[model samples]
Target: MLIGYARVSTLEQNEDLQVDALKAAGCDRWYVDHASGAKASRPQLDKMFELLREGDVLVVWKLDRLGRSVQNLIELINRLHKMGVGFKSLTEQMDTTTPGGTLVFNVYASMAQFERDLIRERTNAGLRAARERGRVGGRPSKLTHDDEVMIRQLYESRTVTVRQIADRFSVSRGTIYRAIEAGGVAQTEN
Candidate 1:
């Protein structure tokens, strides 16, 4: 059985073209979704998956209509394969039930992996360059070194309570405790 799936980004878009294509492709049953391809949840698509059985072929008007990204498309296709089901995309002319189609899909998978590797390499290089320039990522410390030193002194003198120190620094008691701890001050009941 060729169960078709079609999707449009919005309800305003017409699905007639996709419907016609699916019908012409000999789809036995079809489902339509009026949701963004980026969205993981689609009621009609979920329903179609639930109804799919082994030996069933999932058909779509276009590959993009069925997945958000190349990685997502690969995952969906792999999932269908694992279930003993096949996949076909009308626009891309891809059919996992055929040997040639499987080879093409594998090429797509490799390309997606290569793209991911390139992105990771660029990001790491950027991070390294930023570090060389003395630039660090993450939120700046709320308390400065001088502030931590003062907090440690106040805490050690025992003249002010931890609560008082926290109020003076306009920070939480936990922050004050951390500052004192950094200065080798043994924690005591406040």
Candidate 2:
């Protein structure tokens, strides 16, 4: 049984092209996903996987129609293969049931891995560059060293409220509380 999966990235994009190709390829049943956006769920894809059996083959008009990322594609294909089902891509002429097709799939998996490696390497290099340039990746402190000393002085004097200190520094009362705690200053309701 050939079960076809059709997808469109957004609600605005129609699945007609994929549906026509899948129907032409003699798909017995169709699973359509009008994905719309990144956060949207694909109930049809999940239902199709659940309906697939040992002898069932999953077909797609294009490789990317099944997955947005290579890692995701490889995982899905591997899962289908383990379940004794085959996969075929209409446009790419890839069929996992044949030896040559298996080789092509392996090549694709390798390419996906290569792409992942490149991304990781680039990210690590960028982080190292940022570190060398002395740019740390967290929020800047609201209080400078001079401000810290003044906070300690004003807080110890107990002449002003924490809310007052917070207002003076344009920060939240929690920030004032945190500064006091960090400096091991005794906390009291102000």
Candidate 3:
């Protein structure tokens, strides 16, 4: 059985092309999802995976239709292979059931890995450059140590509720609560 999976990033996008291709390729069953590839969760894909059985083949219009990252695509392929299921990509002409297809899969896998490494290297370089310029990265701390101490004192005195204290410190109530939670006995002393 050849099962097809199709995905598009937006709800408004059409799955016609993918669906037609899958059907033309003789897919026994098809699953479609309209969701961002960046997200890990996809209900339709999960269901399709559950329905998969040994000797079944999974087909897709392209690689990105299956996963956002090369590592993720490779992982999914490996898992399906271990389950005695096969994989086929129309655009890439890759079918994991034959030696020729396996060779193509490996070649694609190598390219994907290379692409990931290049992205990582560029990101690291960018971060290093930003650090050298003294441009601090990440969110600024909501409060300094002294501010936390004062917040604890105010909490202990019962002068203000958590929300009121958060407003006073220009932080979230959760932040104030976390500070109190982390302070332990020190908060009560304050």
C-alpha lDDT of all candidate models, in order: 0.93, 0.90, 0.90
Candidate 3's C-alpha runs over 4 A off are 9-12, 132-135, 144-149, 155-164, 167-174, 177-190
lDDT by residue for model 3 over 13-83, one digit each (tens)? 99999999999999989999999988788999989999999999999999899987888899899889999
Candidate of highest lDDT: 1
- Give per-model TM-scores: 0.77, 0.71, 0.73
Residue 145, model 2: Cα distance from true site in angstroms: 7.1
Question: Candidate 3 overall Cα lDDT vs. reference?
Answer: 0.90
Q: Order the numbered candidates by lDDT, best leading.
A: 1, 3, 2
Q: Please say which candidate is ahead in lDDT: 1 or 3.
A: 1
Residue 53 lDDT in candidate 2? 97
lDDT of 3 at 167: 88
**lDDT value, residue 59 of candidate 2:** 97
Candidate order (TM-score): 1, 3, 2
Positional deviation of 5 in candidate 2, in angstroms? 0.5
